[model samples]
Target chain A: MEGFIIALFVCMVLALISKYLSIPAIPFYILAGVILGKAGLGVVHSDEISRFFSEMGLLFLLFFMGLELKLERIIANPSKVLKGGFIGLTIDMGIGFIAAYLLGFSLMESFIVGAAFYITSTAIVITSLIENRKLMFKETETIIWVTIFEDIVLIVILALLSASDQNLLFFFAKIALALVFMYGISYYGKEFLVSILDRDDELPILFTFAAVLTTASFALFLGIPETLMVIALGAALATTDPDAFEQHARPFKDVFLVLFFVFFGITIDFSGGINWFIIAVICSLAIVSKLISGMIIGLTIHGSALSGLEIWSNTISRGEFSIALAVLYGSPVIATTIAALVIVTSIVGSFTAKYSTWLRRGIVSRSRKKALMHRPH
Target chain B: MTLRSLNLPGVGTKYEFETDKGDTVAIFFTKTGIIQMYTLQKGCKTPSAAEMSPVEARRLGNILTGAIIEADQESVEIAFSALADLRITIHTFFVTPAVVGKTIEELQIRAKTGTTVIAVCRHDRNIINPPPTFAFEKGDAALVIGESDQIKTFEREIMVN
Candidate 1:
């Protein structure tokens, strides 16, 4: 208990410092875990209890995301949502899976690797957009919708993939059932829950937390990934009222999230045979794969070469989501590789964002001048 | 022709005129501070009468006519007139250096004025009908509602220039 408390304190301190310093907090949290973990000072041990609770951090995080989602907005822009989601996921996952396969990973390992790579960190993307004051721009809105769609697709894919080995038809049937259940919960169950919540003037935070946990556990029982189930619950709530859920769950989310990072940091074995070559290969793959995928999606959608490049550059930054996926799957190599890639890509992405406007302006000006030159005057 | 010769919506006068393509105009009342404006262009569809209230159409029409007359060098055709009324209420007050940390209610009482605090603007977020217990922070834009004379005095007394 003492060690856990100490580790938590250290992780919080690191996270606070990193937040102010404009550094991504995930790496610091992971570092904190390593320092206190068995691999370092051994102040904290990697135990199943800690792991189980810490995993809830991801669930709450997704739930929080769902609260913000509005299905109407997606329905309004179906073409962009569907095309961008399908293309972006396919390119990122396909290339990543191929790379992992080439690196001698088993099919399952490659599949997990692909899944990890395919998901762009929503926190990182949204934060960057807000910071840049580009959140209101048309292109940014498009990107946001695409990212949201990708997240939804990921939740479904993760759930299905994590289900026990079954025939294709069985898997399809399970997916259909999950969708129907989600719809029912969203339409009917949500209103019932909200009314109950409204009547209870002194509703304890534990009740809400327990409800989410129980739902996730129930999902696991039904052969669904807990992460997917949690996210689905969140998405359903999002269809109703986000503000209430945000108000209720925010405090608990913050507490467990800190533990989640500490646990993640503790799992990193820095000194246990560092493979520099493998790290380098993974880092390179991360950059190339995302860049190619983003560029392809941008070009395909906008039909503008310049916009495609800009899109490619912007999508490169990876952070918490990538790390969380790695940790969830218990792949240390994947985690470390993703961590290194995030650092590299954030630097590159920041630089790209800084100059993308200028590049876009130049391209537009050149095109205009060329058009004028071609004029009959 | 005199200005009164033109049949304006408010003035109850009807005048026939032609407007050039891609011409924009704005009409507004100098007294009430209401303004309405739109563009007259080829291949542009006008909003339906049902979409706009009678008063709004009149205001919008006047503004459009005024804009067209102002840009008389361009040809324009004016038929039935309508206006787009943009009502802007000046919900303004000042943040005094002295009353920095006090709650809004306490400040309202201490200030000894009937200036109703309508809203508080903190950074990008706007809090409307903020609670009495809501403490005032430095650099907050407090939107007050009251009689014009009282508001002016309140602004002068409380708001820092």
Candidate 2:
């Protein structure tokens, strides 16, 4: 109990520091977790309660992500979401897989690692956009489409990765079933559920929680990971009147998310057993590789080099998704490595976002001056 | 009727009107800022979209071409007026205490020396053309527009020694 209190306090301090400094909180939280964890100070240990909260955090993260994704918006630009997203994911994941494989990871490990890096943190991107006042910029529309696309792609990848060694047709059929069930619930089941909430004003929060848990459990029952299902369900819910449902659900989502980050910090092992040098190298490579891949794909699709660079820089931020994947399937060595990489990437990405605009503006101004100097008098 | 049109510098179109059958001729400005004059004509038809709203078609016809032309004009003007440029920089030492709750006009007067408060940066956000009643806060960076000599005087007076 005393240890838990200390852990919670540490997390709060780290969160505050990160917020004030305009830095990613993930690294500090992970550092705090490492210090309190069994591998470092041995103040905090992996327990059932912590594990449970961590899982809940993952559930809520997905739910919130799902809520943000409005299906109607995707429907309006299906090709931009699906085709562009798929291509971007394929290229990014392929590059990452090759890099991991060459670094001595097995095919399966490489595949998982590659998949981890393919997904971008929409939360980070959105926050950066708002901070920079670029949310309404011309490039923002493209970024939103691509980011949403990447999220859906992550869901599909998670689904495929978690599947057993079944035939392709069987795997596809299962996915189809999941989709039908998701659509059925979203379309028909939501109205009945919403009406019940309407009758009872206090029931909305309870209903949202119940719906998330039940859908996640159902997905687990069907041999699918709850993470994908939770996201899908949240997405389904998002299709409803966002203002009506979101206001109630947002607080719950935030609380669970904070707990998730705290739990993530507490579980990470920062023992000397892992090679810090290797981790640093891998983290740098991961950020650079992902940034390059995103830039290439964004430029190809959007036809703007600057827009591509901005998207690339923003998308390079790795957070909960990578850690979640690492914890679920990776060995402690792999998990620690991935966690360290995510922390580094997030910090670098945030700083990149903070300064990228200034740098771009400087370049533009210099070029304009050059043009003026060369003008025929 | 004698109708005359002139290409006004730094402005768009200007039309002048005169009439042979003028009787107590009076000119009135329309709500849309266009000047109207009563005159007799052989025939009149409302202008087509091509003539009335050429900007829309020009924008659609080629955005890059339009942007290039606009940019060229701006560059030419800036180059020609380069000597008239006045740059000013003001530093506030006790921004939070001195500036907060002070009106823009008050700050302008306090800063004095002819410096114009053009913009303020706070919390990593830039506020341009800040209102008169806008209060300054801690860590706020202000962009003052004035001559170098005036800016130096303004900073010395308003900023903490």
- Name the top DockQ candidate: 1
Q: lDDT per residue, candidate 1, A216-250, as tens digits?
A: 87876766566766766776766655556666788
For model 1 chain A, where is the 10-residue window of minimal lDDT? A129-138
lDDT per residue, candidate 2, B1-161, as tens digits? 56555321111233445446542222222112333333223242111111213444344334433322333121001122475753333332225466666777776643467766677878888889778778777677776655556656765666543
lDDT of 1 at A48: 75
TM-score (chain A only) of candidate 2: 0.88
True contacts kept of each: 0.00, 0.00
Docking class of 2: incorrect
True-structure lDDT of candidate 1: 0.64
* Model 1 stretches astray by more than 4 angstroms: A68-72, A166-186, A189-192, A196-207, A270-272, A347-351, A358-377, B1-161
TM-score of model number 2, chain B? 0.40
How does candidate 1 fare on TM-score? 0.66
Off by over 4 Å in 2: A82-87, A165-182, A199-201, A270-272, A369-377, B1-161
lDDT of 1 by residue, B1-161 (tens): 12112211111122222344433332222111232232334453231112234566664455665422223121123333343443222345447777688887776642665567777888969999888898888877777665445555665666644
TM-score of each: 0.66, 0.65
> How does model 1 score on DockQ?
0.04
